[model samples]
Target: MADDQSLITILEDSREIRDLLTETLQHEGFDTLSFARATEFERNMRGLKPDVCIIDLGLPDRDGLSVVNTVASNSGAAVLIISGRSNTQDKIVGLELGADDYITKPFEIAEVVARVKALLRRKAPKAEATLSKIVRFNGWTADLEQHLLTSDDGKVERLSFAEGQVLRVFLSKPNRLITRDQILDDLSNGESDNFDRTIDVRISRLRAKLHDDPNNPKVIKTIYGAGYIFIAQVG
Candidate 1:
């Protein structure tokens, strides 16, 4: 059962899917709002402040990926892409564009619930050792609580929940080699066969945000076959 305060917004055009998800999630103790069009979803989301947004790629009003990007950039909600496009490329693209997770058509409702639970777990505040909420590294300041990054030049960038998690992993162990498996373990993201590719795409996006050149990266150096090392001296 989800927390009473946890709200889930479902944006799917299919009435069957939309209603099914709403019924199932609501039955599981989650508050849900279903939308058939991207326009209404976008408008209501600004005020609802849901904890998770389940989006379908095929929408009548606008591209679902565009909605994913917008939500990721502007909100702290976890973005889950539920689409009929099952190709590897589509999943990769969705993750690259800021989705926290992906599910294809004909997916089991149980899996959806599990995925949502996992995302919520990751979003939940940790009660472990105390750490600073603000971290400075490589001429950048990260406000972990707000998921905002400020560059030395005064430009501020908002980080998606997924990006913020990846960044936290790197910052926690600077100048140390961190394997992809270690990253997944630290993130508490369930095991998947596409783990490598998923981590690579996330790292690539984080690098771009940090202004690190992919061709010749300085901060995060990829080890040919082992893992990656954060070279910057983090403070």
Candidate 2:
């Protein structure tokens, strides 16, 4: 609810589905614009930038994946694909191309609304969770704005949105023990709790990107039986 009147663009060819989605989103206090073709959506995007765009693959003009790639590359809008294709491969392709979330057809309108809200929450800026645009720790610089990490030797590592968020949480409380629950709560907007494994996985991935050895890490240290401690001195 950061912006109660946040605009949402819907790009589904099915008239019935489009009407239902427009009604459901409007009921949730969102402003919506529906399009049956990708060309129309792209044309209007020049005039109006939406907070979130719901795209379907079965477009009359072009493949929706192309739209997802183009929008992600050019704009900061959150993209969600609602499609009838339920294949896991198709979903993966959509996500890999930068769609925030994917929902297969025959979905509940309530779930669609919930997913849109969740995506918006991710896009919204959390003032407290943010760090300086750039933070340096032990010869490594994390450019939070660019989502890139530069090592002392000038080796650059790219960060996914989730990775950047986890790194921000660590940098916000440098050298402090941060519980898994705290990390999960911060990232999940307090809507989830069973994230022990998820947190571990993200931490492991971050460590790998930071080149921190698991056995004797210098940056992020695991406090066995408690939580993680960012060993870096943030500046």
Candidate 3:
């Protein structure tokens, strides 16, 4: 594809879901950027270059569709709409605005990863989507070397130690599945117990904060007998 190291930006508002998705994306080997507002998203689009963008239509400060339009006008990155809205008109408008795909609410996490791989594959298919050292998911952007997540408005979200660590793992690998065992092990730093339902608890909080439905689930999916997956996109 682009280079097997494409940079993908995640324009989401929730820190908990952000951490989980970032971890999962990094695990499969792709660069990642994360943001929470329109200002930051616009700023980053002007400054940084991303390959694919996953825009969350719901934002506290502004509607994410505006960011998508702005990014499409300014950058050549592939655009993917990640929205809680499942209306046909919304999807048509987003795609007409230049989004490559539209993912509805309450989607499976595995499906998200699959869409990411497909988006990355647009550059060229080699089975891995072949990230070119960076990944652009939505209109939002991230600069791995600088370790900063920014938007088109110039606002920046500096990641913390743990957040960055989690982001790194997800961006490092794209489309690769992650399990709860792996999540708990990584998050616990090796210290876990019988009552260590910390991972599930964190995921639940994240789902709420990210506006993901627990019953239907959008951004993350339970693997039934396995664990969970980050559904960063839908086909």
Kindly indicate the candidate among 1 and 3 with the higher lDDT.
Answer: 1
CA lDDT for candidate 3 = 0.61
Q: Report the C-alpha lDDT of model 3 over 38-117, residue by residue, as the tens digit.
A: 78878877778787788888899998888777665446576778888888778766654546567877777767777877
* Worst 10-residue lDDT window, candidate 1: 188-197
Model 2 bad stretches (over 4 Å): 130-235
Winning candidate number (TM-score) = 1
TM-score of 1: 0.88
Which wins on TM-score, candidate 2 or candidate 3?
2
Off by over 4 Å in 3: 1-4, 125-235
TM-score for all predictions?
0.88, 0.64, 0.51
**Which window of ten consecutive residues has the lowest lDDT sum in model 2?**
190-199
Report clash pairs, candidate 1: none
Angstrom error of the Cα, residue 62, model 1: value is 1.5
* Superposed model 1: Cα runs more than 4 Å off: 191-195
RMSD of 2: 5.2
